[model samples]
Target: MEDFEQPVLSVRKINKQYGGGCASCRGPEARGLLKNYCPVCGTVYACRNISFEVYAGEILGVVGESGSGKSTMMECLYFDQEVSSGEAYIHSYKNGKANVFAESSQQKRYLRNHFLGKVYQNPLLSLKMNFSSIGNIAEKLIAAGNRNVKVMESRGKELLEHVNIPLYRMKEAPKNFSGGMQQRVQIAKALSNNPPLLLLDEVTTGLDLSVQASVLDLIKTIQRELKISMVIVSHDLGVIRMLADRTIVMLDGRIIEHGLTDQILEDPQHGYTQKLVQSLL
Candidate 1:
């Protein structure tokens, strides 16, 4: 899509690194030591100069292999992990003028609760195993400053229903549910705040093929009904092809190609991307 209107989310030159870089790996292009690691200093360059935009009500997919840093980028966007260096702006936050990465911890928490939602690949990261599925959703609502138990409960039940979780099971704990059920609960919890933007990191990674299809359908339904912008990270190009309007192909911690999903799949330019598409077929 054209950039005529302001994007819902804008991120520029995001770089996340672990450990200090040595001279041997400073200028990654010149050094080229390993995929994203510097054996010299034991530093791992997880993400490097990644940039992209997510327009209002659109899904932007980030596809890559395990070490390609797509998940790291998602973590940075949701503030689950701090960026080593970058600027990110959300249209609803400070009118898209302020850099969220530079915001205070309290401000980030505010954004997470009121402006953004994230569903982790691992339900353990976001869900309280012992809490009722509805209670998990209520926790997010409470974080967003909702104090009325009746309102929270009503909202939680609505979300669970939307995600296809039965009302009778709303009181059940996620620990007692199946993997697919737990993911559905997480999706319900993520949408509890009705945030404008959603971050999905490897959401369908570890599920049966049939279960994956169901969850993918649930995500598509949520996107259509909510019309919310999303940044979905996955190692599976097939998932990206099915869900994303626009896609970014990342390799070696950097974006190798980005364009409309169909265009990239039909005429992938990068060697890595071509292989990815081929494998998808």
Candidate 2:
């Protein structure tokens, strides 16, 4: 029980909705519709006032099926997608007093470059396919203002090695590697800046089972070694069981239940959650 009164990351009332709302979906006059969508307006409420806290060195798992807005939430946090309305605070940023969503473009860039790291499910989104794997790591270091060529090379090698990327192939382009290898390179690059918080959006989703296990093990090792706080999104309950200390279950753009992973496993309150856990068995 570290002091979670001060969270590494605090998110409050974050909302993301696609399309304009009609009278049937707007404000106090709103009526609920099918699965986070308004039939009258064609408005999809991707995330509805989602809020959570991530404390230092703890992994918070967000589990939801496709279209549940778990991925949308991660995108919003990383600023890949803008929020319709929300507030998020990072303890390392302005002493946790500033709302990141309201920050200027320059300030947000600074936050992304220095305080946060993200691993997208698609390696193409994260890695420069043509650049040498080590060069990919160097690119992130450069963004963080590391100008020393020798230092950058050393750090890159160290990270790639940590992720089980052979130094021999460090000069190879990610485009030439297998999917799991490409993801390993992406992980190396994400850690290059030594970001305090890491956001992983379905990193192991499309990998082979063995490869997923390897990546998951590597993640556990890194969390143990670096004590980095992580928010991992997965549709797979097994992945959440293995990685998350605390788990939040999301459905139809809202969190229906959240608790200790074991507690949720042993005693799920929500019908959807019960079904999800039963599927694992």
Candidate 3:
């Protein structure tokens, strides 16, 4: 992996909350209590004060169980959901000075099309099952302002081959392909524009163990070949161990621990982190 002196993406004090904060549950007294359902106001804190830095060509893992705010963090970064409060800066987008959270809708769309690539947990969300494999990739190219059909088709074929999809199946609809193949197509589509940043949310979930291994290997290969930065969100500690350079452990919407993947596994600092690592053993 390539090394860098500065972070490619920086997120600061980000929070995504539901419902207005109750006076009783809004201050220091409510620090740990905020993760629980606020009985007074029925508020749910999806993410509270999340902050992290992702460097170029690095794989940063965000690991947490369901409702631990990891998915929420991914969604916020993808612009699928807005943050209730905080700032995020992308070094490539604006030299890390402009707050990405404050971008105009048009600017956000531009960023999504030109700079970001995201693979959702569900192929249904990332792939257009009705479209042919080539067509699906072509859509991303078109979104990035490429209109030459021949060029788009050529690039699509190259991406499909890179992801190891058989050339004979390039015209098949994703709905007809196996789940693993569908995911490969999704990855190809996400990489269509050669994005600078890739966000992966539970990419290997629900597949056979063998299939999961292949997919993870493919991701690692892509990272090495392309030198693109990634933020991977998964509940599986093994997945983090396999792919992450650095990892952040989250629980109850707060980050409980973060460090090098080996360090976190070998000597966990937080109680929650210790339990998670032990469970993996």
Which candidate, 2 or 3, would have the higher lDDT against the true structure?
2
Ten residues in sequence with the least summed lDDT for candidate 1:
26-35
Q: Per-residue lDDT tens digits of candidate 3, residues 1-281?
A: 33497788899988988888888678656853646568788888888899999999999999987899999889999899999999998887777799988999889988888889999999999888999999999999998899999999999999999999998999999999988899999999999998889999999999999999999999999999999999999999999999999999999888889999999999999988888889999
Q: What is the alpha-carbon lDDT of model 3 when measured against the actual structure?
A: 0.91
Candidate 2 stretches greater than 4 Å from native: 1-5
TM-score against truth, every candidate: 0.97, 0.97, 0.97
Q: Taking the candidates one at a time, how many backbone clashes does each contain?
A: 0, 0, 0
Report model 3's TM-score to 2 decimal places.
Answer: 0.97
Best by lDDT, which number?
2
Worst 10 residues of 2 by lDDT: 26-35
Residue-wise C-alpha lDDT for candidate 1, range 90-176, written one tens digit per residue = 988898999999999999999999999999999999999999999999999988899999999999989989999999999999999
Per-model CA lDDT versus the true structure: 0.91, 0.93, 0.91
